[model samples]
Target: MVVVDVQNDFCEGGALAVAGGAAVAEGITRYLREHRAAYDVVAATQDWHIDPGPHFSDHPDFVTSWPVHCVAGTPGAELHPGLDTTGIDELFHKGEYADGYSGFEAHACGTGDAGAASSAASSAAGRPRDLARWLTDHGIEAIDVVGIATDHCVRATALDGARAGFAVTVLTDLTAGVAPDATERALAELADAGVTITDSGTPS
Candidate 1:
């Protein structure tokens, strides 16, 4: 299972707060606590931006890059307070240099490339093996993704998971979107790409 960016920055009161982010955090914690056994290996991704380049623009344009957020070593970069990560097997950090919306852009810890780089270009160039290889190595054939901002990171993760040939499902109730219209469009896009959209309360 993949839990997409549930970081504080995406939640309420953070720099780039998304709607219902806090509720998503709490719900995910509860779901994991009750259904941890349903998943084989659980992993999570966070927007661990470490550099303030084009990804953090002075003038705002929320579509690409808007405000500075999820900077490395800051509290906003951490997971939401309501979320319990005890069951997570690994953590992948992304957006260290560029605008990383997909978990695949992240590198798992213990890899040499998992840290703040001197520059955004260097960090992108230094990215280690992607999430696909890691999933394949661990024999993960399917992925259930749940998290904040359904219109952005969650959408990207699910699409990438599908592209990698993994059966992907986005737990609708476990996600919060930045905007309702965009979220609807993102869901439609995912369905068009063959990703399943469903509520987490129901069984697959």
Candidate 2:
């Protein structure tokens, strides 16, 4: 399972606050608890922007660029408190200096620390790998995705997963979108990409 950008900056009271973000965080934790055994491994992805050039905007238009958020090591970049990541085996951090939106763009870092760099000294396997590399190394060919901003990061991650030849499924109930219409369009795009659009109740 892949949890995408369930960080504080994406939730309520956050720099980029998505409505229902807090609810999605809690829902993901609950779903993980009751269905932990359904998947062999679980991982999470976080946006960890540093400089990111024009990705941060003073007069943000809300697309392509956004208000400064998920700055490295800041509380806003940390995972949401409502999310229980005890079952997560690894974490992938992305966008240290760019507009990265896909979990596939992330690199695995050892768990416990939020926004840890992909170049961290080690991971569960003693070396960091991009999401696709890590998953492939673990023999993972299919993935279930859930998390914040269904129209953005969530959508990107699922699409990339499919393109990488990993069967992908997005649990709609466990995600919050930046906008309703965008979310609807994202789901449609995912379905068209051959990604399974389903709910948490659907078995992996």
Candidate 3:
């Protein structure tokens, strides 16, 4: 399962607050606690934007860029307080040097090429592990996705999962969106692309 960007910066009272983002975080935590055994590897993605760049613009276009949020070492960068991350096997960070919406863009701590990510991030151990590589290493053929901003990160992650040849399912109930119309449109687009759309009650 993939939990995408359930951070404080996307939750209520955050700089880029998405409606019900906090509730989604709580819901995902509960789901993991209850259904963790249903999956083999449970991973999460975080928008760990560190430096000040175009992604953290003073005047964001809201389409291609956003406000300063999820900066490294800041409260906004941490996951929501209500989220229980006990079962999370891996935590991938993205948006450190550029604009990143898809969870696939994140690199697992200690794995991959390690590129320009800070030493503090690499201190977690392991190499860089992108979502595709990680899933492939684990022999994952399908993925269930949930998280904040259904219209954005969730959408991008699910689409990328599908593109990566995984059977992708978006857990609608466990996700919240920044905009209703955009979320609806995104869901439609995913469906058209052959991604499954289901709620928690539905069997995987």
Q: TM-score for each prediction? A: 0.88, 0.91, 0.88
* Clashes within 3 Å, all models in order: 0, 0, 7
Worst 10 residues of 2 by lDDT: 112-121
lDDT of 2 at 196: 96
Please write out the lDDT profile of model 1 over residues 51-159, one tens digit for every residue: 7478788887888877999999899999898888888777788888888999988777542232233134345667554577667767899999999789999999999
Give the distance in Å from residue 65's predicted Cα in candidate 2 to where it truly belongs.
Answer: 0.7
Per-model CA lDDT versus the true structure:
0.84, 0.89, 0.84
Task: Judge candidate 3 at residue 29 and give its lDDT.
Answer: 80
**Tens-place lDDT digits, model 3, residues 113-204:** 33334234445544555778877877899999999879989999999999989999999999998878999999999999899998987332
Give the local distance difference test score of model 1.
Answer: 0.84
| Model 1 ranges off by over 4 Å | 111-129, 202-204
lDDT of 1 at 74: 96
Candidate 2 segments whose C-alpha is farther than 4 A from its true place: 112-127, 202-204
Ranked by TM-score, top first = 2, 1, 3
**lDDT measured at residue 188 in model 3 versus the true structure, 0 to 100:** 99
Best candidate according to TM-score: 2
Choose the strongest candidate by lDDT. Answer: 2
